[model samples]
Target: MNITTPTELSWIILLQSLIPSYKKRAERDTSVPDAANKARKFAQRYGEILESLKIDPTCQGGPLDIILLCKLREQVLREVGFKDIFKKVKEEENEKAISLFDNVVRLNDTIEDEGKRLESLVRGMFAGNVFDLGSAQLAEVFSREGMSFSATCQNLVPRPWVIDDLDTFQLKWTNKSWKKVIIFVDNSGADIILGILPFARELLRRGSQVVLAANDLPSINDVTYSELIEIISKLKDEEGCIMGVSTSNLSVANSGNDLPVIDLKRVSQEVAYLANDADLVILEGMGRGIETNLYAQFKCDSLNIGMVKHVEVAQFLGSRMYDCVFKYVEV
Candidate 1:
């Protein structure tokens, strides 16, 4: 499947709009030693590189596209010795989300209508996705006052989302069970535990073999493959079950990605192997789903779900910030 920035998007404009926020985030990352000084240097070096790419398109020795730009930003971060800057926040949020996981699952279980339950699950995913710290505005608000999952769910921008395809997806969900489902997960804390795990659990209970593809390394606040494994281990019972559902059919794969945005062609061999037979593919996060691969097509069914966090993205979609996208395609 081919994935590129939307035709209407100007690469330079998008890059310019995004760079300042990213620079601020890097500067605020206290995890790196002498972070302020390092971040300034990082910003200067990254900006210089971008200028070179603009002056000479072939200067980077590769396509100077959105994916390439994101990768370049991350490469600079690592070079500046900033690794997993959100580690502490991720751990703290994970603990809080895990503590509330059972209740969230039980709430879903109590919903009698299948369609409504699925809607709730989708809403939960959107709500959990709001914990992202990559967006400059969100990071500021999150740092000042914590977010409540339930409150966020209730407050999501009213329906008829920018790319609402949830109704069609619900029809398929009710009529058939996919043999295998691959979910490209995003973020840590509520995003993975509260949002995605319950949805994946439902799939497992429905007899689908589920593969969760996570980052091989950290990017912003996205969870890593190893961290996901540990989270699952902690949530499972002595019987090796998650809130009573067997985890025997659940698996995790490293996506061989270090950036929040993913390039499908560059995923790990293991992920490619697992996805070979997956009848359903779900990309869940603003970076992986909305900003990058919103228009990507797959051999089987695919769902790209996320909330628009950045103004540039929201404007591109002609939607308000925090508006959700549930673009579902069946091939």
Candidate 2:
């Protein structure tokens, strides 16, 4: 989606604005005991990135959102010895999201109608999106304890969403069967355990191979490949294998590049190979779907599901904050 009025989401604004609230966010989210100092360093390196982008940082530069600012942030974070800053955050949320899985699955199991169950599952995915650590704004609202999945689902007002593609999505799904699916995951914890994985489990139940493509390195609480392995590991019953995960039905791949943004045309070898055979592609979370691929053309059927975290961006796209989008485009 396009946020045309110009945002600090771009390289120029990032340098000009110097990344707002960095001191607060860094202190809160990072393990660097001296986040204030790191924020200063991070800002300095961010300026260097802007210079490399050929931007004066005062006037104009290349297109907004074209250059991945998350990439710049990752480099800065690593240089300051805060590579796994969100590690504890991911683990906590993953455990919390996992604890609710059985209850969510059980709720869907009681629904006799397949369509209704499927809709409920999709809702669960969106509800989990509220747990996003990507935006500190949302992280405060949705990740709190005692915030039940059903409660979150209940709060969702159906339709009139930022981009509602449910009718098209349902039409396609009802008529087709996918043998394999590639889910481009977003945040860890609820976003994965509650959101994407349940959908994958359902695909497995219906005879489909699923590959979870995660970041090779950390990007704002989004699960790393190794972290995803750990989360998947705990799902195993004392038996050495998770029920739906065995049979080679469910697997994970590293995106190879750790940036929060993805330009699939330049995807990693592992993701490229897995995506080559996948009949369906689902890109979840704000960065992958909203920020980068909101209008991305795919060679096959694709789904973009996420919530717009920034109100300015959301409004620029003719929506509002916390507005959910489920856009389905068939190639």
User: Clashing residue pairs in candidate 1, if any?
Assistant: none
Alpha-carbon local distance difference test for all models: 0.87, 0.73
Estimate, for each residue in 220-271, the C-alpha lDDT of model 2 and write its tens digit: 7788888888888787666544543453578889888587678787778989
Score residue 198 of candidate 1 by CA lDDT.
Answer: 96
- Deviation of model 2 at 93, angstroms: 0.9
TM-score of 2: 0.85
Clashing pairs in 2: none
Q: Which lDDT value does model 2 have at 32?
A: 69
**TM-score for each of the candidates:** 0.91, 0.85
Every candidate's CA RMSD: 3.5, 4.1
Weakest lDDT window of 10 consecutive positions for candidate 1: 1-10
Model 1 TM: 0.91
